[model samples]
Target: MKIEVNITKEPTKEPISFEIVDMSKKKYSEVKIYIPKKKGRKSVAPGDKWYVYFYWRDPETGKMNIKCKYYRGINQKKTVAEREEVAKAYQRSYQMLLEQGWNPLKNKIKNQRSSPKKQKHTLKSAIEYALAIKIRNTKESTARDYKFRSQFFLDWADVNFKSGLPLEQFKLEDFYQFMDYLELDYINKASGERLSNTSIDNTRRVISALFTELKNKRLIDTNFVKGIPKLKSEPLKNRPFTHSQLIEIKKYLEEHDPYLIQFISFLLYPILRPIEITRLKVRDLNTEDWILGVETKTEAFSYRKIITKMQPIIGQMELKGYPGSYSLFTNENKPSIWLPKQEKSKVNHFTNRFKKVKKALGYGKEYGLYSFRHTAIGDLYNSKQAEGIPEQQIIYDLMPITRHKSEAGLRNYLRNIKIALPADHSDIYTIDF
Candidate 1:
């Protein structure tokens, strides 16, 4: 293992390069000098640190791992020639150590070898194992979501590959094939419809998570899922319900499923997400201060004022009568006992109910439970604009109501939802043509 180091001055501005020559007649992988980049400068500055970087191939795994020998003392030299001499000296010392079988990762490699062998995994087993770990760490709703997305890849693998395919055998190319399957052939067993690009991308994320877990557990060498590029997904914006549609829905819910009206009120007035509303308990409401403690997506909880619209709705409900621990919105659409298992179904209960109402009204997929929130926010913005309220004041007022952190965020949300359109623009722009 007698290795030689040779320095070469390329006609470049920043670097004095070097290479490792193996006297045993073998070439070392990726041997070079690494110079730190300087802003607004093409050449290496007077005090910039650099290093000799190379790769060391592992005997067991045959993996080329990175190794570096830094040359900070080179910077202490005042002149270019002096610095080059010091760098060469350091490089030679490093080359000698390499010839003597010195390895930066020697201790790491020994520890890895001494450690217990990782359990082997098949494609099916690896996915299941990863899912188990994921399910254990995440919340029930999140765990369910992970599992739901994972099933798509699991089903695809079962059909396409041998049942006993080893985890290592599933390469980057195979993952791309699975992605193609998702894009072209896969259909939802429940909906009997092809998944949108966004849905497919979501599935990609879940699969990526699983592969990452497997890699961490040492079930496989590489996470092929990470190599797959993310597909660009067109954002799916839910349209706000028109005034006539809102009136129709309100009238219909009042007669058919009045309980749902209470649930929708939470979405409409407080502008709560369906999931957030489901997580709310009776104790969260403060009638004295007219403040509603909301379960937010990011934080443990947040507060929103009980607006004039929601005041009557809360008064109608016998929330105080129930135990404070009881969920605010139950299957019965009132504050009542909610079992642990029932927590998962709370959002779906309202969503399905809303779907039924939409179906009866001859509504399409564009209208959803979220549409109520968008509709309410959009209408509020339009109403305030009509009243000649300053736009900044209107946005500031809506901030606490919508729970947006910044004016820019709220503005972007309004823009993304296509709200606050100027009324009768055609009439204003009309000319005698």
Candidate 2:
């Protein structure tokens, strides 16, 4: 049987008040015991379900929103009459609450505030939550890296700590122990090689970034990852290709794999990293305006001019009727739909494809796909120097093309690549003699 809960007020100028009445016909005054209809061998029971239903005005939308409160615990009563008594008690409580300005929405906030334990997050959940936020703010490749790194850490934690460790309870000492594990004990399952200092540091950086986000969200008291120092990484192994090596590689790519050469052009001309090139959409290119839109890791979008050298290559693409959503580079090295899951694989595909070219040319690990961009930047820097441009002016001019935000960053990159070297040191030796 259905129960009615009517809350009415006095007939005076003030709202008439009545705690309880029979008004089940009115939509807002219905409390009911729900029973599922028997189907096949299943039996229906009185205590199967119970609900208190009413209407409350939504503060934000100014619309009447239906609110429901379910009390399955009422079924704990032994008999039908006892369950009905408990249900009636619950209805009176709900009626009392509604009369005192208790909103289902607002009461939720009140309960959360009154009970801080509801906000507690376990170590695994905290990272998962942080990752959910991080993925939205970063590129797909970067998000993949974050997810892989975060999962690796979680797997490590599963082995070391008891399951479901609360985030706040994870101490700085625990983080240091994890770092030690990465440096000393961690092994690559695919290759069976121990993690290098650089690899360990990379893990640390990703975890630190995730923890930083967790702290900003107040999920944790502190980012213990920051307390641990970075391990000493190995020396830079990837160097820019020499001028002669560049010509050789280009010639090899053009002769053997012409499609791959176009990928190189985008990297060199736009100074895009391999992963960034994977992010390009067909619509990002504007042939008439001679501009290419690049979604960089740091910025949402940036424009790069399509220079005269790049114009011919863009024309060769023949990008006329292809959908704007199509990827500029794909498996066949042409424009097509690039699925989000396929973005990282496409990068690895191009990289592995380039490795074949590298093998054909007898190139070492130091020289790979990124060498094209590095070589182009070095050539540009040297070309400006040959024009007798000032070092400061050259840095200022290179900033936009290189997509470096500051002159110092560009200078640091040039210095690291050893492009800004002393010219004709023999003059100094002769003068000293």
Candidate 3:
């Protein structure tokens, strides 16, 4: 038995048209039956009828056995086009199968419908995904910190977990043990010292955030990181640079390194963190507005200080790097290592340089890199008072410059910094009214 399906198309000048012809040699005309209309579907194309007929040979009788035979028109359906396509495909296969002397229907048929692929809910993939999300949302230095912590989580899971199974199986006990391991057992490989309570707390915090993100995604039953408390640590003592010390440092840097002058000057006028200073790009400076922008760490602007005269300094800086092209600090190929490879590397590359320069000029280590900012703020506060400006107004003026998030923190900056105001004689002339 053999069957052939011939397809012809209309000419390009004519409307879309297809003609299918069943040029089949074998026909089970006796067993052929009409395929019925599918219920609740649109009627098939006008006057189009369908028929099916199948047969296989039996070994014992040496006779052909009929499997199924159908012939009919189906009602119109949204998929009438798809139905027509399947029919054409069946017709195309008929002659090919006959030539091969095999019938698929005579044996076990292959299922054409496929099942959907599943997503992995395993712990390792989820942590990596969450870490990626973390890195995207934060700055480069912050991303590095997250990556370091993520390694700890992975190493612990590899050793302690059962092939590091899915998050759904992660329990509260697992969270507790991991946190305890960081606090009590873990040691810094480079420093050869135990982690501080504060560091342990921060590690716990990042891990907790990891679980929280997974929980929100419905990947876990709960965050599994609760009841952990932050460590209570003492704030380090920070002091300001004095007027004479500032004069000395400037005079030395002007003769020694001209680039250091502009860089250090930006830190003083803007009163920004060292990291924030290093992250500044050429585009962040606006000479027209006399404002320098702090884009990441803070959203405030630093108006060029009147006493230091920052606008001229910024103009000179623009000439060094193409505007909107590179960092304010360097036009070199790569960014400066503001976030040094390790925290201690900062001691040699950053603090020691400042420390060495200052100490050579007869200043102690007490006048640190941040002292420049503290000194500027202290001077601004004192200068305003010396100019007879009110206390509340001075605080209001410097709050944004210092980028203190709250009033209490601002008060802490003002404490222990003495500013002598001239005796107020205006009150003596006022009546008791």
Candidate 4:
């Protein structure tokens, strides 16, 4: 926390026999000094020579911060006394900046606004920037989650402004109010229900992330969503599809929509999530052993081994000309494979088709596309058990193939199945021979 202060003579045109040189390198927590810049020497007043500079690391960015104040010194031709007064006025300006959280000793503006402010950020632009970085770094599934949450925030924030709200002037309470609006005013477009605390909290997180990045880039004055607690939320209860229901749905799809049958077949056997299934390309499937390298949520090759059951579906799909450059499951008319990072259209088409099929089957919203994966998990669990696989063994074998993060996710998937272990009661009853 030690900051050494010293004043060095400015480089002047008048040559001096001896120059005062301080050759010392030291780290500082804070430093207050004059800004050095070459001035035009056309008989300018000393008052105009008064220049103040502040340098520090930004609180949000932790990067070296720099700001300069060009105060109008007493008009050009000023006496020594006037120059002294101007110097004192600039000194006062520097002190005021220090008072407002500029820690020269630490070389960082403590509260983050002491530095020169950047251009005001529009809500849409800020969100798009963050989303671009998120999409670039993460899997499409995670990007979709961020995008999903960000939309609600933009919708809630931009209700009053058509262009976009400026993030610079936002207060901490504005975020709180945003959460309140999410709870009361915002409606879930999918379900037509008031936004839940969980959903609102998720939106809050996305905004916090946006602010964090914006502040890092010095785009915003402060981190608006920082330190806000997440609202408590109730966990969702999922209903796994039953075997009879699956059979009925399958028969319906087989008869009416061969495309959907192939699509669902890919989802059910390997128990791939909708996003992973959407990433499946025809060339990704190995014709020899059918080791379909799946692009899962966490790791691309987590589900490297395609199940023996899925091979038949792949064959059926192949027979229909699932070319190397096309997606494994496509619309009735197979579109070309979504190249590297573009999956928006693929997801949209897949979701719309799933919705239609689910509606046609008269299934509730709860039993949507993801339920196929859920049902697949249940089927795998039961079939493995029936074949005398140990409980832990079944979970182990399925974890890599299903790409579940842990045994806990697998257990959670089975929570809806109402499974009960069969125990031998003969020991307690003392069976007679």
Candidate 5:
């Protein structure tokens, strides 16, 4: 391989010129350019000659080799000092490469042995490249999630990734290490709680999706997480309020803080998830039919839930002058406005207030905001039993209203409701019909 330099002066800059040329065709796959730093020297004139060197890989043994190449301006002549400076710069570069253990002659011999190709993958470079490819095709939210997980992976894992690391190098042990980190990391933004099994499971799902993409790209031969087990989570449970408990909560809120009444009603009757109920708009309500159209976060089409019992409350909200804007729940003091928009905090505040209200009403610490939703489902289940409806029918009705993904999820919700119900009621196992 031969080293060559072609110099071109910038139109407005002094002393700094760019040297452009293909070095060893076998050493580097792409063209290389060397930009000289202006070390307080006057700019080169047109037709000046500058000396440069290029490095190439030997075809036989894949070692680096160097040769000299020179550049001359088409219309100007160069002073002896300018030529000397260029040669000195080349010498410095060559010395630096030699210090790094690159043997120019050995590379030339190595290049002769086989066709020149890009170097093999390092772990870091492969991961970076793979993530970049994923970012381009995925949603902004998905990309953000990948970026978050990748940051943690980079911090904990040792991989030589510049552009990206190869997926094939990732192991199941790495996945387990990541899970352990997540589980042991005690800091949580929400509630300042330790990392729970649920949170770790969510992280695992995202990572699994990321590796799945790498597999699809043929970057990895197998899913590195294939055999990794997830941390065990507790069974699904719902905390529901009893009938007397509900009345007491209503009385307390009505006397002390009326602002939360509408929000509570939205939760209690129609059984809307807090997120869905908060985002509801006035236009989503069908006044005559008592149906509230709920736009879920995961689904595209709007699903309707009947809140016929709350028609008067909905009418009162309209009379208060909150028209078809974004949020349905609003503070009574400012009827025209939705709940204060510090999302996560606002939800937390609501839950905390519910706990306080439950305590005041003598319901103990077990009742919570979610207790309302569970209570509604429990009510429906008991009503069905009273009306001679079978367990399957109760489950079927609860499915759409609860928006549970599977029958088992609905059943679990029901089981939790049963556990929370009053123990002394003799009709616990009896069907009235």
Candidate 6:
């Protein structure tokens, strides 16, 4: 296809219009024009002029097409050299498009109508997407934690979580501001302490993940936190009951609240989490084997594990006035009672009751509800070690009962157990070993 160029001037026109025709001897005589928008009632305006380029290719053979770019100028006059330069630039672009077998006249019109639209990406939008992805894969408790912490991010940054901003738009300054907001402004309602570094770090990690998703989708150019450092946390202090303290609590529960006796046995004897114990039904117990079937938080299927100390307690419960069908612990008489199902609230109540027992026995504030779990695990670790069991083997045995997901998780649990153990044998060591 041959190229054609034209220059023309006409007077007495309302708004000047320029047209270019592909004068090649072809089947269809394709044409393109430049018509500028009029400005207010003015006959001519400098901004009213523009260059409109076009191309036309044969539809049958799928070959090269004739192309043209008409340099349309309105009130602003152009010199011969300027017009020639504009024509030459258009010719170059036309030739490039022709080489790619693009019909400028047809493609340019289509492109003008169907050009790719830009979406408004915000920080809020990214968070929503990230949260949706998390909800699909994570447990309810995990999803709740993410949702709870996400509010801090939204309130601090003053961004909506649903309308995610582009990742590229985030600056280092924004991160520093967020951290400052968490440290200075964000306060825990329960403890009134400034948000902990660990908590803040978790929020940061979520934000980082959001940006990662955006980058993966090619929605953003870069992750803003590429060089940012994670917040550090101090080692947690060990807090667990001494063997004598455990015995004292058990005796108090046996005398005062028979229901609590079974609960304590579930904790110290079988090494069951309070939630796992509460979730247990009468049918979950194996009287013959003295095993308690516990449904773990992570898994759907229950696990049956023996609790030697619990055998006597279970027999005692059977001997007591409680019915066989009743829960080991209940607020009301017999089979069923609707108590608070929230684990944290139940734990808090247990802790308060434990405090009363501790005060009665003259034990200090150091003993808490969690002490029972710590003491049980510590006792097991010591007993296994004394029996010539390797640390790894002990960990492996405890992993299923503890419901730890990874070897690292089990190792951390063991580390805590060791920390909770007494320095002197006579101070807090269990007699079971």
Instruction: Write down the TM-score for model 3.
Output: 0.54
Per-model TM-score, in order, reads 0.62, 0.70, 0.54, 0.58, 0.58, 0.57
Residue 257 local lDDT, model 3:
60
User: What would the per-residue lDDT of candidate 5 be over residues 125-229, giving only the tens digit for each residue?
Assistant: 444445544554333344556667765566556532322444454577656766766788546677787766766776677666666765665556677665567
**Candidate that beats the other on TM-score, 3 or 6, i.e. the better one:** 6
Q: Which runs in model 2 stand beyond 4 Å of their true positions?
A: 1-118, 235-237, 321-323, 425-433
TM-score of 2: 0.70
Q: Which stretches of candidate 5 lie over 4 Å from their true place?
A: 1-155, 158-165, 183-194, 235-238, 331-349, 352-367, 415-433
For model 1, the stretches where C-alpha displacement exceeds 4 angstroms are: 1-120, 162-168, 189-191, 214-238, 340-342, 381-400, 404-416, 420-432
**Lowest summed lDDT window (length 10), candidate 2:** 35-44
lDDT values, one for every candidate: 0.73, 0.73, 0.58, 0.61, 0.58, 0.58
Native-to-model Cα distance after best TM-score fit, residue 339 in candidate 6, in Å: 6.8
Summing lDDT over every window of 10 consecutive residues in candidate 6, give the lowest-scoring window. 72-81
lDDT assessment of candidate 1:
0.73
The residue-by-residue lDDT of candidate 2 on 1-433, one tens digit each, is: 3555566756678876554433333334444444334564212265355444566655455455666665635555433334444455455555544554455764663463354344656787677656655654345456568778888989988998733798888878888888888878878799998987878888888989889888777666678787777776543555788878878987987789989878989888888988889889999998889998997778878888999999998888889999999989988667998664335677898999999998999988877777788878988988888787888888888888888888878887887777565444464564552
Would you list the clashing residue pairs of candidate 2? Answer: 8-18, 9-16, 9-17, 10-16, 10-17
lDDT of 4 by residue, 224-249 (tens): 58788777765353356787888888
The residue-by-residue lDDT of candidate 6 on 181-283, one tens digit each, is 7768877789888866777788888777766766665656677765578777653432676767667777887787656666766777667776667666676
For model 1, the run of ten residues with the poorest summed lDDT:
109-118
Candidate with maximal TM-score: 2
Selected candidate, larger TM-score, 1 vs 2: 2
Angstrom error at residue 185, model 5:
6.9
Off by over 4 Å in 6: 1-120, 136-139, 159-167, 189-191, 205-230, 235-238, 288-291, 319-330, 333-344, 358-367, 420-433
Model 4 worst lDDT run, 10 consecutive residues = 22-31
Each model's backbone clash number:
0, 5, 14, 9, 43, 15
